[model samples]
Target: MKIATYNVNGVNGRLPVLLRWLEEEQPDIVCLQELKAAQDNFPEGAIRNLGYDVVWHGQKSWNGVALLSRVGKIHETRRGLPNDPDPSQSRYLEAAVNGVLIACLYLPNGNPRPGPKFDYKLVWFDTLIDHAATLAASGAPVVLAGDFNVMPAERDVYKPQRWVDDALFAPEVRAAFFRLLDQGWTDALRTIHPDETIYTFFDYFRNAFARNAGLRIDHFLLSPALKDRLVDAQVDRQVRGWEKTSDHAPVWIVLADR
Candidate 1:
């Protein structure tokens, strides 16, 4: 099975770009972030026409998440992170497709750090860590995939010093990411190509893509049950060069059939 994750930025505005990629890639399952549209505006029919059954959680002009399956029904497991005292944003969506539990998330960017947004990012990371621990213990095949928004290590960023003051590269955020990995979830791309300088996102400014000034923020964390099945993991870097494409390109993993 092939599973992919992409942050579309705005599904409605980028429908054409998204459709073209989907048609070309044909992944069995896809996790999408940043729909930037309300539930009613999800354009379900258009996606359905492409032979995908999708489940999505959407909010207007902001964060959203969705899971699309081309081979089978998507049995929605949850819409948002559990126990969120003030649940408002649509940043998470979980579903079961082809017996694999997929948790798609669009983590807070926490920009202009040392502020409420940064604090919330940490709190949100805590919630995810707690829940992910339980999922790791369940022994079921699970994939935590999406735009994590945090650069886990110096190697994951283009110029580590340049982003020292940024929340994505902050020490605290990186520690939280490591804590998640401690729960036995394998970082799919890193596990497959540890020394490679691979990246999934590039800023539109300063010709970042042309210079290969990118970061590996989008990720896929695989549970132990799925680790051995992982055959390959990669980023579709060329997608970032496409016209009107999202800053993020698709990151994917291929697994052997059970």
Candidate 2:
């Protein structure tokens, strides 16, 4: 099965671009982040017309997440990340599709570091780490995919030194990501293309996309049970160049049938 993750930026504004990609790629499963629309604003009918079953958690003008399945029913499991007290953001959604547990997440973009936003980002990562450990121990075929908003290592970014003060590349943030991986989840893309400098997001400023200056922030983490099933992984970098497109592109993976 082909599974993909994309940060659409705003689902309503970029629905056309999303539709075009869906038609072209035809992935069996898709996880979308940054809908930036309210629940009522989600174009459910339009997506359903494409033969996909979707479950989404949406918020107004901010974070949101959704899971789409073409091969089977998407049995929603949860709408928000566990352990988040008074969680108001729609940043996480989980579902069971085709016997696999899929967690779609839009981690916080803690810009302008050394502040409350950055602190929140770290706290959120802690919650995710705690939850991921439990999921990994469950021994289920699980895929935790989405825009993590983190550059795992210096190699994952275009200029490591330049982003030293940036929250996305901060040592603490990177450490949190590693802590999650330590729970026995395999980074699918890095696993497949170990030495390659693959990237999924490019800044709109400074002609970053044109210059191939990007960061590999979107990811698919496969649990141990599904690690061997990972067949291929790639970033649809060209999609970033489309008109009125999102700053991020799609990152996808293929898994062999069990």
Each prediction's RMSD over C-alphas, in Å, is: 0.7, 0.7
Model 2 clash number: 0
Q: Write the per-residue lDDT of candidate 2 for residues 1-258, one digit (tens) a residue.
A: 999999999999999999999999999999999999999999999999999999999999999999999999999998887887338999889999998999999989888799989989998989989989989999999999999999999899998999999999999999999999999999999999999988999999999998989999999999999999999999988899999999999999999999
Q: What would the per-residue lDDT of candidate 1 be over residues 83-176, giving only the tens digit for each residue? A: 8634799988998899899999999998879999999999999999999999999999999999999999888999899999999999999999
Q: How many clashing pairs per prediction, in order? A: 0, 0
lDDT of 1 at 167: 95
Reference-based lDDT, each prediction: 0.94, 0.94
Backbone clash pairs for candidate 2 read: none
For every model shown, what is its TM-score relative to the native structure?
0.99, 0.99
Alpha carbon lDDT at 187, candidate 1: 97
Q: Candidate 2: what lDDT?
A: 0.94
TM-score of model 1 vs. true structure: 0.99
